[model samples]
Target: MSSEEEGCFVNILSRNISNIVDALLHGPENAFDEARKEGLLEREDLDRITNKESNGDKIRACLDIIEGKGNEKRICEKCGQEAAKRCVTCGILCCDQHLKRHQQEGHNLMDPGVKIEKLRCTVHGDLFKFYCMDDWSLICPKCKDGQHKEHEVVPMGTAPNKLKVVLAEKHCRVLKSIESNESQLHEVQEEEGQTQNAGRGAEDLLEKRRKELCQIVNETVDLMKGQINKRKMEKLSLLGKQKEKLEQQNESLHQEKSSLQTALQEELDTASFLQGSKDLLKRLETMSDFKSVERTPLPVLDFSKEEKNLDGLITLNKNFLEKIEKGPVEHPEKVELDQNNLRRLYGRSPSLDPNSAHRQIKISGDLRTATLTRTGNQYPEHPDRFDVHPQVVSCDCFSSGRHYWEVDVRSSRWWKIGICLNSMGRKGGKSGLGANPESWCLSKLNNEFSAYHNKQRTSLSVPGDHERFGFFLDCEAGELTCFGDSRVLHVFRGNFMDPVKPAIGVWDYYCDSVHFVHLVKQTFITN
Candidate 1:
């Protein structure tokens, strides 16, 4: 070949090799290494072309151009001034002074190749415009034909719009959840307010009831004192009568003795003296006997018995206050609720009747609590009072509908509380609460407890610390349920008679007492 032709061919080879080196250096560092690993190129050939360690400067230069830093120092080759723009056709930059001349000479100023190179894949060195759905990754056409051949793929430009749609949906759902939680919180707060108001009102009512009970007890004490005084006066009058009779007898005897002494002083003949002596002896025999005056014992007051009665009255008043304070029985759903909840849900507050309390059962002035006394109380004789057993009935009775009540059994170690028909026997015999056909009760004997009905007893497991017992009766449904600490202890089903009242019984044991939990209906208004 001619020398000129040879020189032209060598220049062409040098330009092509320079272009290849530029492309390799601008791409990812491991692009050539990956090609060799995939058997697409020989390792020695890739190493010879890339010369990774020796091309650090070239790599840095390529990075600077990709990041636009190289543009700061770029200058026009012909004018030796700052370049205004780059040309795509010849891969050259020109200043404003030379740009017009270059443009008029038909040079294309756009750099389409630069944009295309930016979209290239690091692994395959090919344009990456496809997205893989299965792998959640970006892919080139070559990758789609290789590892991602069967994967779900979409155009990369549309992927962002799809992701935005999903994000918006998730945001809306989170907003709804927040609103729902806020609404629930508001309801809870309002309920809390209602509860507080109810509690305040209940406290006021309890205080009022307590005061009334105290007043009644004071009056009872005053009445008892008056009776004691009256009885003392009557006994003293009887003692006075006895003394008068004894004084009269002493006078008569003294007169008789004086006559006998005078007759002895007169000296007489033996016969006359004998006759007078015989008459005197006869008179002495016929006269009433002389005896020393006997002192009578004065009537003494039994202070201990009076004090015991007073104590019993005080205890009864305290128990009555406790019952008024108890309010009502709340539904089982609110196990952790306050007693005010019971008042709001249930309408009746039951108190023990002082008139119905047994003689041995000392009832408080409030008529809500009762205790067994060593000495029986002198309570009024009422048909509802148990003459044989120490028991009392509540003043309230339920004939229909649902009713609930609670008993504070903390003071009663051996006691009984339950429902009883109004016709249940109260005078005597085996007709007391839980001991006859008309009564049912949950009873505690010492530490052990049981349920009794129709004289039959059923064993029960009682918690050691349980101080309160809740009873719910659906008279219409013939169902009764008992609860302790929110746990259902027993459920009884029976064809109970109408007009049933609460009954309480205590054995003749010391310190055994019971309080009927009090409840008022005004507090429960939450719908």
Candidate 2:
């Protein structure tokens, strides 16, 4: 062959080897070693390739194809838990839910111990619980004198001894039979070995081959036993849970039965007591007739000494009364209004959406940055504090500061301006923690500014505060003014902030249905 052609063949061989190696390295791990140990791969042909053949690559490839690619996963029909393949009768696939149904419907349910012999006593019909020995009979204890006394009495505890004696006799018979059978088996085995050795080389080779066959069979038997054990454990686990459930149900029924019995007893007692009471009432009525209606009264007399003691006691009580009167007169009661109660009395938005129950939050697109107009009760003597409490009233899906609405006011009066979000409390308590930030109204540039600059909004106190728990609300810019008894709040428009989508959490926690009110550019609509 040309050198170039030879080099090409070598290259092809090397590439094929490399590909095969890569597949083994990265491929599934269902190696045939496990199959061999478990005796599934015990055929002489398979053994020849794996142990005798010098070609390692060919053997590994054969093993991989056989063990790695099969879809033999035994999934439970109920829970889908994987199980080793086994006979369906073994019940490996059943989960707790399905196994309970099996116990009720399957012919072979969980273990019910040996079927006990039932021989009733001649006298009572109760359960027959004992066994007699001499006659090999079953009977209740009461039957001892009637029927079982003539029999040599042996307790059931000594049953093993009786069984042993019977088994010993059988063994003697079986030993004789086995001796005869062994002679026949020996002849058969020798003949069989000779027949097999016709093809094989020597006696030792044949014997070794025979032993290997036995070992393979034994390995298969062991694998079967392992499968059976695994199946039984799974079934027992399922049954344990079902049994626990049934036990709970049984206990409940027993308690109900006990309660019924007690109730019946109580009713019987009540009826008996009522009848006895009726008899006593009749006796009392009859006795009343015997008493005189208007006879000479028993003498009414009082001792003079006792009368003087009573007078002394009355005088002491009079002095005590005078001392009590001389002391200060205590106020009867003072009425006060619960501030939180007043806030509850001040209700929220007219209607609530049904989805509100699930805490579904939505962005408040309507009311954004509104001028801090002096609300009902927080207006101060001076009004410059409206700008002092610059606030975001509501927000939309976008949350860039650029898209925000701004509110400003220039009023000469000193005012206590505030910012607040309109939100409801969870479970009707305070929103924000225990304190409600839903109805938050900020303090003006009043003495409270120094008091609350460092503290949280919940800590900021209003004398007549309502439910105002405050959190961060991205707001749009707007403006408002305050004068006389009236105040005006306004929203000056701009594009919404870019890119800040609505938060699923804060939106659901905050506003209800928000109503947007756009006033003509410059109008005081306040009354």
Instruction: List TM-score per model, in order.
Output: 0.35, 0.17
lDDT of 1 by residue, 1-527 (tens): 33333223222322344554566667634544553454434455444445555565555433333323232355454555666655533445567887887567645453212332444577997656566655556677899989999987765545444433433443344344335434444443444344334323333333444455576565444444444444444434544454454445445444555555455456642223333444454554444333234333322333343443333554545444344345322223323333344444553568888878888888877888888888877766667667888888997776544667889988877888888887677886786677777888998886888898888989899778689888877765686777778777777777653568888888757768998877654422111
The digit string of per-residue lDDT tens for model 2 on 422-444 reads 23323332322213322322233
Q: Which stretches of candidate 2 lie over 4 Å from their true place?
A: 1-59, 62-419, 426-429, 432-440, 444-474, 477-527
